[model samples]
Target: MPDNATRVLILGHGAMGRAFETLLSARHDVAVWDRDLVTGVETQPLEAAARGREVVMFALPSNPHDELAARLAPCLATNALCVSIAKGLDARGRTPAQVFAQHFGPRRDWAFLYGPMLARELQAGRPGFAMAASLRPSAGARLQALFAGTALHLDCLDDVHGAAWAAILKNVYVPLIGAADGLALGDNLRGFLVAEATRELAGIVEAMGGRADTAYTLAGLGDLVTTATSASSHHRRLGADLATGDATQLAASGANIRSEGVHTVAMVRAHALFAWERFALFALVCDFLDDPARLQAGLDAYLARRFAAPTGR
Candidate 1:
């Protein structure tokens, strides 16, 4: 327990961690750690780092998140509030809140942040926004205050599972969007892709016990645009690079912080169109990345599925 400092321990310093540090370091004490480093930051062991922190944000990629979080569980101070900035599918098959509760026990607090805010832009104080939920939703206020009227629009959301599910599902269509662009598709095609994907996800989440509003909020539309269309997105880049037959480069892009969606494509739990969304995306991504010869047909068929009458929509 250090004196005269509000310790903020940030795990996963890639984009979001640095965004927090770059923005909040001037007013708060911060330390960062990541399992693998794309760029270096002064970091401490998770247990050691958690020893006396007032706040701990888990900004990890979704892969192996459960294992890593379990390892981090005992290290946190009993009162430290945990926040997660992860917005991809869980390779570990656990919810972000579940991971936190397992680690810190019921006495501690936790939160999840999902939105369109890209780590790179957020770090530089660019315009950004996010939806958040916490056991102590007010705990989000501290962070919201830190971002205040800045480009980062911070709002409180009460639905945890729905928000998380929407966040994970949005990753599915971003690659499809990339596939669309790779094959010389227009905005009309991209828009059609997003609309169809949203309807499918909205229905699935509602059936799975989530709210329809989940699909229209910051986590859904916001994240889809950034990830699906942004040139800087690793997932979007993966699709385009693979389309160009640059498997080596595409593979290299994910080496540091691998996109969890790419890996989780094999295990998506939701159904999309006539088949499982996960399965359809997995096949398309594999072809776009592994066998470019089939990119055109895959992209076209996937798009057609979306805009094709919509089953009487």
Candidate 2:
């Protein structure tokens, strides 16, 4: 190994994992472990892959973080930097960082990667950007050093909570954009939805102890634009499916595809984490998700709640 090479163990074999492998393997030693070996990356057991690796990157779904953390906790070497790229809430409404924090003790340091990174674009060596955030000073530096020459440029930021919440909140709002797109509401409506969603995201982030302005950063606005407008976005498709009442669309899309926004919608509703009533647009999306037939009513309610409250709640 070169003096600067970092041993990286990728915990999932999904598209994102392959993207990382393609980018990082150019300069670092990479190994991958996934239950399914569809990707051609070298496979190893959890313990074997994780042990002694300087960095363990998790590219799996949020729901699996708990189990992966359990399996990795025992094997990770001291001072291993744990990185999470998941932008969804786990089953318990904990974010990806929260999941790893549970299992990894002082032996593990933590960081998060977030932004408008599309796996296909990244794997193709197209220019991409992301934020690497950590409270620990060295964690971000290590990531920056590892990806020095890659097409992907990583900026180190200290606002881990803000970046994370923004990323997760964007998933919840993109489906609304998709639903509007499916309904053919025109550019005017799309523009309105984007603005409203961004405002609501900032408000919610602030309510949850994160800086409100962070919503305008790459993790928030940049990611929202990518996911909301992309042709291949599953959350947008789900919104369209809901708007058009087309059940078969999602069925045809495949069962393995999990829409993180679906769970996010449920979580925000059940937990009332941010005084959801203040977020008229979010409330409308949740109502629409619950019953597609209420689409018109949801819109009417959103308009009334938004305009009628100029007095400021």
Give the TM-scores of the predictions, in the order they appear. 0.80, 0.90
TM-score, structure 1 vs. true: 0.80
In candidate 1 the C-alpha lDDT for residue 264 amounts to 46
Off by over 4 Å in 2: 37-43, 105-107, 249-257, 308-313
Q: Write the per-residue lDDT of candidate 1 for residues 138-255, one digit (tens) a residue.
A: 6677667645545678888777667777787677556657766776778897787677667766765676567888878887777887788887877776666666666665466552
Tens digit per residue, CA lDDT, model 2, 1-313: 5777898988787899999999988688898888753563445567876877989998877777898789877777777888988887766778776676678743467888888889999998798888887767788898888889898888887777788889988988887788878888788888888888888889888888788988888888888988899898888888888888886654554323347776777777676656777677777877887787788778767767667845656
As for candidate 2, its clashing pairs are none
Model 2 TM-score? Answer: 0.90
Model 1 collision count: 5
Best by TM-score: 2
